[model samples]
Target: MKSSIVLGLGFGDEGKGVVTDWLCRQAQRPLVVRFSGGHQAGHTVVDGAGRSHVFSNFGAGTLAGAATFWSSYCTFHPVGVANEHRALVDLGLAPVLYVAGLAAVTTPYDLLYNRVLEANQRHGSCGLGFGATVARHAGPHKLHVMDLFDDFVLEQKLGSVAAYYRQLGVSFAEEVLEQQLEDFYRAVDYCRTAIHCTCGRAHFKNAADHYDSLIFEGSQGLLLDQEFGYFPHVTRAHVSSRNALEMIREYGLPEPQVFYVTRAYQTRHGNGPLTLEHLAPQLHPTPYETNVHNPWQGEQRRSLLDLNQLRYALSADAQYAAGLARQLVVTCLDQLDGPWWVSDDDRRTTLDTVSELAHRLGGHWQNCYGNYGQAGNLVAG
Candidate 1:
C-alpha cells in the first residue's frame, strides 16, 4: 500500500505532469488519483516516446499507462475529458478513468458565466468556469458527477443554474442558451459511456488494496490555494494536499510521502504576487514548453528564485500535511543559465549549490532533486 502525493510548491506549472509520469515509471503501473482543481490545469509531460501532452481533466500518469480516479474534490469537465481522451489515443495511449459520484461537474453555463465575470472583474481566470462552478454549487444550484446519468435531474439543475445566472443579470440570448444547453446534454450522454462513473469510497478502497502504489496528483499549486494564496489572484479550489490527505484517511490507505515540485526559476501563469518577478530577467523559452501567451490568462510570468517565500509555502502546507515526509524536486535546471541566485534585499547572492538552498529553506528533505534536460533522467541528491 505504498502511496505518494506530488504537489506544486509554487504557482501552477511546476512540472507536476513530468513528476507524476516519472513516479509511474518508478512503479509497476500505479493508479493516479486527482484530488483537487480541474480542467483549468495545464500539467505538461514529454514521454519517453517523445510524445507530449498537457493534461487537464485526465490524470498526468495516463501517459505512463496509469489508471485515473477522479475523487470527490476534483471539479470535472466532460468536454475537456472528451478532448483530452482523443489526444491520449492519438499519442498511442489508452486511458482508464474512474469518476467518483460526488465529484463536481462544470457546465456550459458555468463556462459562459466565468467568461462574462472575468471580462468585467479581471480576476485572471483560465476562462474554464472553475470559479463559476464552485460559486454555483455553493448556492442551491448544484451539479454532481452522478447527476450526469439522470437526464431529468441533470436538466433541472442546468435550467436552475441558467435562471440563477439570469437573476444575477447575465443576459444570454434564448437561442444561444438553448444551443449551449443542447450541447451540454449531448456531452453528458457521451461522457457517461466514455468515463467510468463509480459510486462511493469502496471502489477506491478496493483500488488501494489492488494497486502496487497510488500517486495522489494535485493540480495548480500551493501558493494559489483558495484559503492561503494572495486574495483576488487565488484559485477558487483547494490547491494543496488538504483534499488528498482526507481521501487517503477515508480510504484507510497508508500515509503518502509528499513530493513538492518547483521550477529552477519561479514561474506564474496568471496575475499574482510573485516576489520580484518583474525585477528578474526572463530566460529564453524552453523548446518543449506548451504554455504561452493566451487570451484567457494573458502572458506567462517569471521571476528569480525566492526561497524565503518558498519556505513560507512549505510551512503553510505543513499545517495540513502534518506527519508526511517532504521531498523537494527542482525542475527545469536546463533552463537555468550560469549560477543560480536568490534575492537578498535589493541585491542578489549566488546560490553555491542546491544543497545550500535546501539548507537556507531549513529542512532536510527525504529526497532532493535537480531534474534537468529530460523527464526520466533524475539528478541525484
Candidate 2:
C-alpha cells in the first residue's frame, strides 16, 4: 500500500492540515486516519479554491474529499465533531467522519473538570478536556464513543463519571453539565447517520485494498507528546509515529512514509520552554492564519527557528521512526523574508536559512516542502 504518516515536529501548529489535504489529493483521496490527539487540535487546511478550515474532531483531509477515521488512540468529542460537521456543510462540504467504538469520548463533565483543574494548576491545558478525558480512562468510570448509541450504558457512564469528578473535588455549575449533556445527545443524533462506529484500524487497514493509499494524519506535534515531551506543557497523547507504526504492524500494511512538518520559524501557544524565546520573526498577518490568542491556550507566541529544539524533537521521535522514509514539510516561509539566522546570531550570512536547515536535517529527506507547496521539483538529489 502507498501509505504515509504525517506528523508535526513542533508545538502544535505545523501546517499538517494542508499537508494532509495535499497528500489525500495526491493519493487519489485516501482515507485520513487520526491516530492521536482530540478536539483540541487545530489543523488548518486551505484548499486549492482558497477555502480554508481549521479542522478539529475531523481529519484534515476532509476538504480534499477523504473520509476520516478516528482511531482507537484518539479521543472522540461528539459535540465538536457535530459542530464541525455543521460548519463544513455550511461551507458546502460533506465530510465522512467515523469513530472507533473503543475510542474514549470527551464529555461536558470532562471539559469542566479540565478547565477547573487547569485554572488551579495552570499546567497549560488546551481547555478542551482532552487531557482530563485521557486521564479518566484509567478508571472504571470511563466513557467511549459506542456508549452514545446505548441509552442505558450512556446514562450509567455519565452518572459514574460525574460521581468520580465530584469525588475528585471538581466544582462547577452542575446545571451546565446537564445542558451540555443535552447538547451532546443532540449532536450525536445529528451525526448518527453519517458517523459510523467500527473497529477502525482493522476495518480501514483491511479496506486499504480498495483505496490507492492510507494517510495517517496525526494531531498536535512531537514537542507536546505525553511521554517524551517536556513536562507541564505537553499534550495528553502520543504525538509521535508510534501509534501509526503499531497500526501498520497490526494490519500488515506496507512501510510508512514519514512526513515531518514544521514551520519555518518556531511558535508555541501557551506556556512552554523555548530556547530562542526572545528572537522575534516577522509575522505578516493573513486571514489564512489559524493560531490565535484564547483564554484556553493564552497567547500564540512566535520566535526564530530553534534548530536545537527541532533536533531534539527529531531525536525523541526517532525511536518509533526507524525504517520510515523520512521527508520534511516546512511552512510559514513568508515569515523569513527578513534577515534572521536560526543557527546563530550572525544575520549577515549569505546562506539561505531553508537550505542550511535542510543540510543540518541531512540529505536523507526524500521530499522537502516549503510553505504551502513543494519548494521546487525534485532534481535527482
Q: Which is the leading candidate under TM-score?
A: 1
Tens digits of per-residue lDDT for model 2, 277-297: 676776666666667788877
User: How does candidate 1 score on lDDT?
Assistant: 0.82
Task: State the lDDT at 168 in candidate 2.
Answer: 89
Candidate 1, residues 323-377: lDDT per residue as tens digits? 7888888888777667776675446777755666677678767778777754565
Candidate 2 Cα deviation (angstroms), residue 139: 1.2
Q: Which candidate is the best by lDDT?
A: 1
- Write down the RMSD of all candidates, one decimal each: 1.7, 2.6
- Looking at candidate 1, the ten consecutive residues that score lowest on lDDT are 277-286
Candidate lDDT scores, in order, read 0.82, 0.80
TM-score of each: 0.95, 0.93
